[model samples]
Target: MADVDQVRPRQAASPSMTARQRLALGLLLSAGFTLAVDFSILNVALPGIGADVGLPLDGLQWVATAFALCAAGFTLLFGRLADMFGRRRLFLAGMALLGVASAAGGLATSPAALVGARAAQGLATAAVTPAALALLTTSFPEGPHRDRALGLNGALMAAGFTAGAILGGVLTDLLSWRWAFFVNVPVAAAVVAIAPAVLAPDRLGRRPRLDVPGAVTVTAGLLAVVYGLTAAGDTSWGDPRTVAALAAGGVLLAAFWVIESQVAAPLVPVTVLRRPGVRWGNVAGLTAFATETSLVFLLTLYLQKVLGYSPLVAGLSFTVLGAGTVLGGIAGPKVIGRIGGRSAMVAGFAVQAAATLTLVRLGPEPSWTALLLVATFAGGVANLVAIVGFMVTATSGLPDREQGLATGLATMSQQVGITMGIPIMSAVVTARVHGLGGQGPGAVLGGITTAIVVNAAVCAAMAIVAAVFPRREALTQVPPAAPPGT
Candidate 1:
């Protein structure tokens, strides 16, 4: 095994974060949290939005689908744009757009209006996520400080999703479903207001020309792919719409590959993909997100369909898992410092697999204490650790100039994983239930159990892959971040 230092030289020294830097970090995290929350915030509100707007079920689904498609599709394009233009400039523009879109969503009276707003919000998110992450990576030189910052960012982002789930229910019940969208307005406003004061301005020089053909083909390809996967979840892989969309996406992506090869300034530079950390690290990230998200989906079904928990109760139950994620996020940087990112990531996946497997023992009437809480909590912790480690590994050796592209690719992996995983697992659960020849609680339990096992298997397999791959070395440590108020 090689040392991380072999892959990339260490910085001269670890610097303590200034108060302004801390404020900047906070702003970036706030933007990330808002994006994460929006990803799931509308889930519970979907039915309400449909009813109030008199939307048909099919149209209602677009509220979520539009966001997923646009966010996943435009991320890479915007990431490169941030690199070429300016991260801070892109960040501010994204936040402003997000705020406007949120307000539009809240005031929407028609299905088309609402879906359009969601799509705009997704576009803004695609812009903001990579730019904010790039700003963070560039602002904090790689070392313990960078690792710690990334860890905290991962933790908060995960927590934001959980918070959105619970808060969506609360807002829908107490006030209105529109509150879910309205809530982001103030958060975006604050971030946009404070960001310019704290974040360093982007240094402009002779910038490379944009790769228009590569950008267009890749973005269109990603949109089609994500749309197909999203449709697969609602329909089936064999559905004509799914088939056509996926085929079109593949063809477009192939064209993108050819364009990138020939272009003077490719949207995604081939050299970046050649890095062991970038390649294998994204694989780890994709697997980590896919399995963990599928587990959550299965658990939601188990809690609601089998155990008969209310949607609100099921949402609240995962708070334990969210708490564990928070703790793991706090501990992740330290663990990576001790063992290296590769080791920590492998261990995180291994532990997550074991934790997921424990739930295979769950009966129709299982002990929530022994099974649900424990497993979820442990899985949550392991999931965040793996995520943090993956990010650290993926961006480890990249120059500041390329941080936007790296972070964009990293975020894109996550969105693709989340979009792809649920559908695949849903297919598995459906097959298992049908094979059992029943629609009763017993069949549901059996199907859920099978899905859980599959999730564990996937995690274990990825762990083995991460362990066996020798493209990169373990992350090297530096002096820890200075204690607060020091």
Candidate 2:
């Protein structure tokens, strides 16, 4: 039986970055920017897309939410592909798909076309995210070298999300909303051209073909889960479609586990989840991500619907959250070192929890300056603390050879949170605001607040799990959430 050990340690001298490793990381970072930016930027253009395509307000939610769903659903499958095929080839192809999809989306004449294109774009994103990360992990040798590369990769992602808002806002304001999608064309082209030279070959062996049946079952199951959550908000709890979807999702997922358990190279190694640090890390990530994603979705609505801010302003408002994330990403290492990952996770959660509960009690009529200030500074802080802390935990204990898979799994979990969180929050908002006439805004705000509160509580729980990490000793020497880029 071929274990992961068949692959030898590949290394570079001096900076310890294999030239290809450096090149791969660079291309991957570039590829990653589009995903981060799309999250904050698209909402800025959502109204424009809706207005042009004639989508109902509720239907517009699908534009953003569906992207997350499709992206999350395909990540694991794609991640496995990168492992079985070639990571570099898959990454570049994924970039090409993204570019094509974005172009189609931008040129769409109808909502259905746009949504279809966006889903394609999401699938492309899923492929790139995992493939790129896995490529980087394999390209870089283990130990401090891998850690540094991972840290930088984390920072770039943090920076990209923040930078995305700034660029998205500027572009949407200066040109048509189409420019947001258009912007990717040049970047994607650049990455596609550069990626091949730097990236490593895929870790492929002439193994049996992937389990198509199992893959399909898992994908359908996940799609159903995403669908159910999205539909649940607009429909009754007993809605037949929703119940059926959820049930199907559960059954299919169970089947997936059975299939994987018997397979040679499983998509998710069951043994992996048994590790305390990895388990808690993922738990923390999901909850924290749900909170943050829900916050952005709700914040965009509040800024646009309630505050009457244009798409540009709403996007600009998000810059603050991005900024905070950057700060936290940069600071996370130090914070973890100082307080320990566990303490940092707990303290960070406390900080975010305080911010969210406060938002709940505050009246809706608050001034723009006040709202912007809170959303910008507090959001940033909460985001940085939560994400970095969670990531540290996620990366803690897996064997070096499996780091790429671990990274892929962690990244996939983050996407899943985004997928699951948005719909849940959106549904909560829709339900709470269902009957409200003049108080519609308040009801929506309350629902959002509830989601945030839930997020804070979940983070607090993650802290408990983080407390027991094996790296508790080193975690103390570092601190979390300083700034992302710097």
Candidate 3:
């Protein structure tokens, strides 16, 4: 196997995006949007799905967990496959699989069938996300153009989640819960059809051998960890299932590390982790996702349980937060260009910390105009700004060959953060609520306040970490574009 860290020639800066590049970007962004939409679109429709399929509450929960677990577990493995085989090939296959899985999910009549379809969807997503992102980073030269593209990508993804939430409710009411799953079918088909014509062809290269042991161990470990975390949400951390899963995961991961160090062609080169950009960028991304997702959960609870808002009303209230994120995505690239990614990241985190702190002021009385909207909106903006910065930072200065690995690592951090955040905060809030007597508005508010305070402290600490760490050079700078026609 060829060494992944071999130095390559750097390309001179390109002037602007060609028409083909633009089309390819559109297809990539569509894939991202579809994936993000799928994640949240089922949230409001879960009850309806459970009813139609005769699923119990626990079975209904698996509808979401199956997707998250598979996606988180297989992302790194698929990412490495993309790098070794072909990113474009992997991307097209993923899209096709997603379409097929979505169709199956929509047609399902039983709980097992629907859950199986969801797991397939998650696997497809794991393949598509890293491959699409890797294609983007490689195709777009790392600079203003790439930054702009990433900003739009971030914005659309955030918008997709928000749109899914509202659209899921509407579709479930107007038609059926199945419509939420059916929606992605057409989108995926369109991308698959158009992508071949528009996107650049994958370059033919020597096929590097896979690190089978590393692949098996890491995938198993991640699945175990994600399963344990998900289980912790429903039961206590001390539950036997959770404890066993976590312990197994820890052992597997440790074994994976040992195997990677001894292997000649490791799945992930240790040097990649040594790079300050990749290391701190992932840290920032994980922190940002964890805190922001927790904030959303807390706010949702506050809006419904405390303020007595209808689910629809609470969902609508978040439209402002979505709007704020879009605006931040539009501005994030420009801000990074002006101040650099590290500085932009630190600033975004600092602002996010402040915004989260302000949420502690929320109370039993509705504060839509005064505190709630402003804080949520600010939190959304800061969150995206931080997210965009993290992506730019992580992908920067890496050669095109390793883009898949870099993106996979970054995306895995995001999935893990999103998976873990709600559970951790739930545990905290449960403890605090019980301490203060129990489930009343005042107790819930106090519990939420405690969680928000912890979230704010985490943001603040990460900001300091980003600021204090000196940026290190990548293993190798991004290589120049391949000569035309090989």
| lDDT per residue as tens, model 3, 199-313 | 7888857877899999999999999999999898888788899999999999999999888888999998887877777888899988887887777788888888889886667
Please say which candidate is ahead in lDDT: 1 or 2: 1
TM-score of each: 0.95, 0.82, 0.93
Better of 2 and 3 by lDDT: 3
lDDT of 1 by residue, 1-486 (tens): 553423455445545788988999888998998898898888877888899988898887798889999899999999999999999999999999999999999999998889999999999989999999899899888878888889998888777777778888888888999999899999989988888899999996779999999999999999999999988988988999999999999999999988888888899998888776888889998898788777878888888888898778888888898898899899999888877888788899999999999998887774653588999899999989999999899888888889999999998988888788988899889889999999998999899999999899999988888886633232322447899999
How does model 2 score by TM-score? 0.82
Worst 10 residues of 1 by lDDT: 470-479
Of 2 and 3, the candidate ranking higher by TM-score: 3
**Between candidates 1 and 3, the lDDT winner:** 1
Please estimate how well model 2 matches the true structure, expressed as its whole-model Cα lDDT: 0.68
Candidate closest to the true structure, highest TM-score: 1
Q: Worst lDDT window (10 residues) for model 3?
A: 1-10
TM-score of 1: 0.95
Off by over 4 Å in 3: 1-15, 368-370, 470-486
lDDT scores of the candidates, listed in order: 0.87, 0.68, 0.85
